[model samples]
Target: MSISGLNTLKKGQHYTAKELDSFISTTDAVLLSNNENQLFTDPEREYKVTHELDGFFEHSEEDAEKHFREKKAYVVEKA
Candidate 1:
């Protein structure tokens, strides 16, 4: 899948172990280090995080379209 654009997830999303590791690679050490020094430490946290990430990864395109459409409508109304 593609990995860039406003539709692409940047942070704050659920992620699989592999996906989380990939994210960790691109993240700052301080942020990760403060989070118990690991990305997938707790199973419960992992589950929740992964679920959120999955939703974003799967629906980001649709979400972006909807977001832009709403923004455009708002701008039109304001003008």
Candidate 2:
């Protein structure tokens, strides 16, 4: 299935950054993973960390950064 953005992104699921970029460009949703998010995550917040719909999210937008800019996964952080 095609995802909308990073927030709506489910945990432990595999997704390509190229695919997500496409979804973000089409909406008002600026990636929450934009490093501007402060809270990151909140139990009371209904908003997902990696919001995929409008491409706009408040916190935890950087959640997808690792996947988007990974040059050497094992070499850098040993995933």
Task: Please give the CA lDDT of all the candidate structures.
Answer: 0.30, 0.34
lDDT by residue (tens digit), candidate 2, 1-79: 4655433344334334444345445533334343234322332222233322322223345574422332111100001
Give candidate 1 misplaced runs (Cα > 4 Å). 1-12, 29-46, 50-79
The ten-residue window of minimal lDDT in model 1 covers 70-79
What digit string (tens of lDDT, one per residue) describes model 1 on residues 21-79? 45445643212222444445542343122111221112356455432111101000000
TM-scores of the models, in the order given: 0.26, 0.28
> Whole-model lDDT, candidate 2?
0.34
Winning model by lDDT: 2
True lDDT of residue 48, candidate 1: 23
